[model samples]
Target chain A: MAPKYKLTYFPIMGLAEPIRFILSYGKIEFEDNRFESDKWPSIKESMPFGQVPVLEIDGKKICQTIAICRYLAKQVGLAGDNDWENLQIDMAADTVTDIRTKIVSPNYETDEEKKQKKKAEVINETLPFLLPRLDNLVKQNGGYLANGKLSWADLYFVALIDLLKFMIGFDITKDYSNLSALKNKVLEIPAIKEWVAKRPKTER
Target chain B: MAPKYKLTYFPIMGLAEPIRFILSYGKIEFEDNRFESDKWPSIKESMPFGQVPVLEIDGKKICQTIAICRYLAKQVGLAGDNDWENLQIDMAADTVTDIRTKIVSPNYETDEEKKQKKKAEVINETLPFLLPRLDNLVKQNGGYLANGKLSWADLYFVALIDLLKFMIGFDITKDYSNLSALKNKVLEIPAIKEWVAKRPKTER
Candidate 1:
């Protein structure tokens, strides 16, 4: 019997999109249970770690976005062929995570002026220093984020680019041809395309 | 032939300690290359992603402290028994990472007043909220961080607790009895004790 999967998160493409992409890629059926933002505060105390993007597999609640994605990656055979290769894939995913954290830190700033300043720094300094390196990595790896073949990291990067652009209000990949190509590659996947076409539209 | 291992980081034991602990727990020999902070600028450009705690496995350099630790965990048989178990371990480790990031962010603040305020928030707000939950997890797992056994998450937690204390200038585990017991359980490992006995002493 197929194990039932359900993901709980806000109705936005933030952290949960990568897990959603992985499930869509594998054609696995899952409950993408997205709640409204106002409902989060009431439900927050009951979450396993007081965070969203929790994946319930066979009724076992799993916390952490990357952990959920990694599990799904393993299930769908999108993980590395060997332990070492898996490490490389993880490294790529983590690099993207580093970028995401830098971009989102400003979003959470309580002070509006400070938030704008931090956002500027992230766009001007952090993005320039990091995105080129990531582009080179994808280029060197022959279009994939880790190895020559597709992995969950590729899905993670493409999914995150949408959020990144939305947060920064700019085209983050305009100059990076490889990343753009990689984004297109991920978007072209039939399952991913289907998910994108049908997934709920949100402001973020 | 066993793969050659080399860890590059500042003389301080921060992120690299967890990787060292995993290697030590497995009785694997590695070169602990600690460099002075003054020498970082010259070497910074050469590092992958311009960060320390880079693990060089057989001359190949891997970036990101968590990625390096995860790789070493697999090498030392400290990883989970299966995909689901691995996800649990990863979730535990990632939770620790989240706490660590919150505590360390203030360390880089340029303003003294802001830094102190942030530090206070980390101690008064963050620790109070996160530590008890972590301690409960340890208690529920029968003294281990995950899987009711000594996974890399256990080692990672114990190793990082020292750095956490140094950065915050207080014993973080004082109020959390189960976490303290978990630390003792990790510290009592024969190989881990051996590593601690001969390891370099540094002020974080």
Candidate 2:
């Protein structure tokens, strides 16, 4: 029997979207269990670590978005063949995570002054330093994020691009042709395209 | 033939200690390549993503601290037997990583005023909220983290405690008996004790 999957998170494509993309890509059915902010406090206690994006697989609940994504990727044939290859894929995914955190920090910054300063820095300094290296990596790897193939890291990057653009209020990858094309390629996938077109619309 | 192993990082135990612990536990010999701060500029470009704590196996450089640690953990029999177990281990390790970043950020903050504020918050609000949960987890798991037996997350947490204490200016685990016990247990391992006794001493 196929193990049932239930993903719990906010409706936004902030972090859980990567898991969703992998599931959709694999044509695996899962309960996309999203909730609102007001319900979070009540929902918090049942969680393993009082965090969201908890994935319920079989009868057990697992925490952490990356952990969930990696597990699902392996099931869907997106993971590498061996340890060394997986190391490269993990490195690329982690690099994307690093960039994502920096880009999105401004959105979560409570202080208005710091938010403005961080936004500027992310746009002027952070993006320039990071995006070019990522662009180069994509180019070198022949249009994929890591391991010179369409691994889970590529899907993770594509899922992240939408959230990144929403948070930063700009399509930062417009200048990076390789990244833009890569995003397009992933979006054009039949299942992912269908999932995107039919997915619920959210404010963030 | 055994693959040649080399670790590139500063002489500190900051993030590389977990990998060191795993390698030592597995009796895998590795070149502990340490570089001084003054030589970092020239060496920076050679590193993947301009970061330290890279582990090279037979001349192939692998980046990211957690990724490197996970790869090494699998080699040393510290990783999980199955995907579900690995997910739990990854969650535990990531939770520790989150707490570590919060605790260590003040040390890296350039502004004195902000650093002091962040330091106070980390010691007060952050530790108070997080430590008890982690302590209970250690207690529940019987001195190991993530699983019922010893896993790499346990080693990772133990390695992180020393640096956390160093950065925060006090021993944060004194009040958490389970965490303290877990730390003692890891430190008492023969290979780890031997590695700690002779490893390069650094200010951080």
Candidate 3:
């Protein structure tokens, strides 16, 4: 018999980190299948959507990061106990993704001038407009991203914050007390702490 | 008592159309609170995440379009029957959103040269890269976006296709038979047909 779960992703965390965090938090065993970048082309056609971060469950493949995180979340008890709460958690998680998307593309720009200009806009405009709102949301939600309790959304945030800080070139949580505390609270989890210390160190 | 659900959004069917489609499909009653664009600044302060398409349930508000759509999808009997099914549905739905996100921003570009360049790339590269895969998925899934059934993801795609067509300046389904069938199948639903026929018309 095979493992109950198999995660197919690049060696670095990137989009797959939340799913990894959730799996780690649950202490569930899995085959973490990380392959080299050059191997992607040969593998792309096998993917359901030609995307990395595909999670295989019981030999059936599922694509999309949040979709995989959400499916595993229910199994790990990180999901909400009810529909409304789940809605809140999903909403908060998607908002965090929205903020991340706004800043991530700049790193991929080939033009140096375009990349720096985009970085300036991110540092000056995008981060200022978005982070304060997220910070206040954490303040209102009692340091969790939703329902005033620990959920997978916080895990998702902590996992992505590394990639985000690398992209934006600073600790995104530095200016906001609530966000900083939220980051601390998530990292304090023994599972996450252990994983963070041991997971591959990537510049991304 | 207040309505069981109240959707706050702009008058146009941009982010909020799928939620509206789900609501109408379910025959669920709610206040369709469409407001003027100028009023957004005032209303923005009260919104969760300062975003529209907020679905209020029993006086509490939830933000994020897909989150609201998923919540209402369950109520409308359009959600997946199991966790695996839901995962498949969500993956497909998010893929639809991923494509939408890729092509939406160019329409808002202030510079005509950049806007046209982005449009050319979308028409030349993005559409060619993405739409056919989706076309094949619909074919493989039996005219549905996921789970080989008519889930709300199908409805979500149908609601979005019109806007995507407008943005791309052509009928996106023109070259893809399965995708064309999926669009027609979704539109032919009595509730959605009625909604589309009667809903406020907009350029977007």
Candidate 4:
């Protein structure tokens, strides 16, 4: 019997959107289960680690967004075939996730002064740190993160750049031409383009 | 020729210890490179993401501790044989990692205050969320994280529990008896036991 897959996450796109995008791009069928804020307490109790974005495979629960994404990516043959390429893809995706978790996840003060301070740190410290590295890697690896082919890491990078623009109101790829080119390249993929165009509109 | 591996990080365990532990337990030889504060600037520039704990394999650099550990784990067959089990192990390990990253990674005012806050949050949020779920999984699976066999996730839990105790200066597992037993059982693995005894002491 085919395993039944269902994803549980908040309505926001913060962590769950990438997984949704991956499944959509792969043309895999799954349920996108969103929970209301008020309904989270009781629902949260049943989750491992009390976290959402858990993927239920045939009624068995699996937690961690990256792990679930990678699992599905492997099933869809989006993860690179060889060990070396897979490692590179994992590294790129995980690096982006780490930066997002640290600088982009926290919502601090609403005051302009504090927001600007946080934005400045992101632009100066994190953006500068990540963009050039990714640019160089793309240049070195012939424009793809792994296998010089469209891997999940490429989609992850596109999602990350999109989120950065949304959160900070800044264009990271504008300065990094290579990354801009890479993003355009990824969007050119038929499945990904379709997924993006038809993706559910949710506030991140 | 066997590819040479070099790891660069600060002296503290923070993110580097897991990679170190996995390599040591797997009996894979690698250069353990530590950097002093003064040397960080030069070393940091060389890192792909300006972060420590980058792994150099065959002179090629890879960033992200989780990615590196996953790569190493796969090489030593520590991840798991099948895709499903591998996903489960990765998910569990990453879930624990998320909690640590959120609650314990901050530079709190002092050890006392940090411990107090961590203890409260662990009891309230983390313990209730993770302990029973993991315990149930272990009980059902016959003690290991996946496929009824030891995996890197099993070892990761051991490291995580030890870190919690080290950080809070209290026995956390006392409350979760199954977790306490799981930790003890993980420690009994011969390779892990030897590695634990010889593991370099660090302020994790």
Candidate 5:
């Protein structure tokens, strides 16, 4: 029997979108459960680790967004065929995550001036330092993030790029031709395209 | 022929110790290359992502400390037996990483006052809220991190707790009995015992 899958997350494309994209790409059926911010406090205690992007498989709950994405990616055959390849994909995914953290860190700052300063640092210093490396990697790896083929890292990056742009008020791939091309390639996947078109719009 | 393993990191166990522990646990021979801080700038360019805790297998380099640890754990027979089990372990490892991040973030603050404030919050509110949940997990999982037996998450948490205590100035496991027990169990492993007794000490 097919396993029953249900995902609970806030109604945002922040962390859960990659899991949603992977499941959709695999044509797997899952409950796309999204809750509002106001409803979260009451429901938070029921979540594992009091966090969302909790995936329920066969009625057992698993927390951690990346872990869930990795699991679903493996189940859907999007993971690497071997441990070495998985490591490469994991490295790429972590690189994308590192960039995301840099952009998102200042958003938590209560001081408006400091937040603006950090945002400038992210835009001017960090992005220039980080994105080119990623762009070069994609170019060298034949347009995929790792192992010269499509993997969950590709999906994860594209989904997060949308949020990054929304958060930082800039198109992240404007200067990186390779990342732009990679994002287009991922979005061209029929299932991904369908999901992107139909999924709820998020502000970041 | 056995694949050659080489780990490169700073002379600190902040993030790389779990990889070292896994390699030791597996009895795998690898080059344990540690460098002083002053030498990093000159050597940073050659690294995959300009980060430490890189594992060079054969000749190829893999970056991201957690990714390296995950790969080494698998090689050492410490990973989960199957995909779902791997997911469970990954979730636990990520949870530990989250807690570590909450503690480490303040250590980088340039403003001394803010750093102390953040550290206070981490100890007063965060630890109290987080550690009990982890304590219950350890208890519920039959004294190990995941799947009721030793896994990478157990090693990861145990290795990080030392750094956590050194950073926050508290033995985190003091109130969490199961966590303290888990630490004892991990430390009792003969290979880990050998590694920890001789590993270089760092001030968090």
Candidate 6:
């Protein structure tokens, strides 16, 4: 029997989307539990760390999106077979995460000057730094982040690039041909395409 | 033959310590490469995303410390064998990462007022949020972050608390009894103790 999994989030793709996509791609049946903003205070108390994107396995609740995604990746055999490959996948995903946290996570800055400054820094400093590196790695690894096969890291990169486009109103791969090609390839995966097509129509 | 792994970082253990610790604990041989201040620019150029703590595996370099640690954890059999356990471990490690990024990362602010304000928020908002939750989980899981065994998450937590002490000159775990106890237990691990005792000294 498939183990019961319940993912609790704020109806936003912010953190929970990757896990949701992974589970959907894997065809795993689980609950996409979203809570209203007003209900967050009460919900937050029940959460392990007062944060959402918690995955309830059987009855045990798990916190953190990467953990949940990685767990699901393992369950669905999306992670590579050996430790080295698994670590490579993790490293790729985490690189995307680093860029997100540093450049995108400060969305709460309402000041125009600060926001623009940050955006510029991201484009001028962060994007240039990461795009070329990813391109080189993709080329070297035969176009995959790990094991020369599609892994969670590849999907994560797609999601990350998609996120940057969504948030920044620009395509990161515009400058990096390999990344652009990789993103397109990942999006074309039958499971991923199907998941995206049928994904809940909501914005975080 | 064992694959060669090269880790490049500043002399301090700010971010790369956990990766180094895991590799050491696993008895995995890798180059503990450090950078002179003068060499940062050239070294930084080689890093994916222009960051430190890059891990070169079999001549392929990977970035992101959490990703590297997770990879090493898998190699050492420190991460759980199954999806559920791995997710739990990931969550624990990520939670610690969140606190570090949100609260501790801002501590580098040069502005004295802003620094103090961020530190206060960390003490008042972040610590309260994380410490109790971690304590509860530790108690619930019989003192381990996952699988009732020493995990990468446990080591991460230990490292986090140690970093907080280093940053603020105050022992955060002292208030959270469970956290303090857990830290002590992690410190007692023979490998960790030996590593700490023999770790190259730096004043960052």
Cα TM-score per model: 0.97, 0.94, 0.94, 0.89, 0.97, 0.91
Which docking class does model 3 fall in?
medium
DockQ of each: 0.81, 0.68, 0.77, 0.75, 0.82, 0.77
Q: Write the per-residue lDDT of candidate 5 for residues B1-204, one digit (tens) a residue.
A: 999988888888878888888989999998989998899987687886677788899988888978888988887889999997898899999999999988888876667898899889898888888889999999999998798999999999998887888888888998889999999999999999999888776776
lDDT at B146 for candidate 4?
A: 63
Tens-place lDDT digits, model 3, residues B82-189:
998999899999999988987886765556887898889888988888899999989989889888999989988889877888788888888999999999988999
| Second chain alone, TM-score for each candidate | 0.96, 0.96, 0.95, 0.84, 0.96, 0.92
> Model 6 in CAPRI terms: which quality?
medium
Q: For residue B179, what is the lDDT in candidate 2? A: 87
lDDT of 1 at A204: 62
lDDT of 4 by residue, A98-198 (tens): 66765563343334665577667777777777778878888878887666787888777676666666777766689877788888997787877887787
Residues A1-204, model 1: lDDT tens digits: 999999999889989999999999999999999898899977777777778888888998888999888989998989999988899999999999998888888876656887898889998888998999989999889999898889999999888877888888876778899998999999999999999999998756
Which ten-residue region of model 4 chain B has the weakest summed lDDT? B102-111
Q: What tens-digit string does per-residue lDDT give for candidate 2 at B1-204?
A: 999999988878888888888999899999999888888977777877777888899998777888988888888899899887888888889889888878876765556887898899989888887888889888878777877889999888888777888889887789999988988999999999999898887655
| Better by TM-score, candidate 6 or 5 | 5
Q: Which residue window of length 10 is worst by lDDT in model 6 chain A?
A: A102-111
* CAPRI class of candidate 1: high
Give the interface RMSD of each candidate.
Answer: 0.9, 1.2, 1.1, 1.2, 0.9, 1.5
Give the per-residue lDDT digits (tens) of candidate 4, residues B68-183.
88889988878878788888788878876765664464333235565566567765766666667767777766777667787887777676665666665565567666667777
The window of 10 residues in a row where model 3 chain B has the poorest summed lDDT is B105-114
Q: Of 2 and 4, which scores higher on TM-score?
A: 2
Worst 10 residues of 5 chain B by lDDT: B42-51
Give the poorly placed runs of model 2, Cα more than 4 Å off. Answer: A107-111, B107-114
Instruction: Sort the predicted structures by DockQ, highest score first.
Output: 5, 1, 6, 3, 4, 2
Where does model 4 sit among the CAPRI classes? medium
Model 1: per-residue Cα lDDT over B61-89, one tens digit each: 88988887888888889999998789889
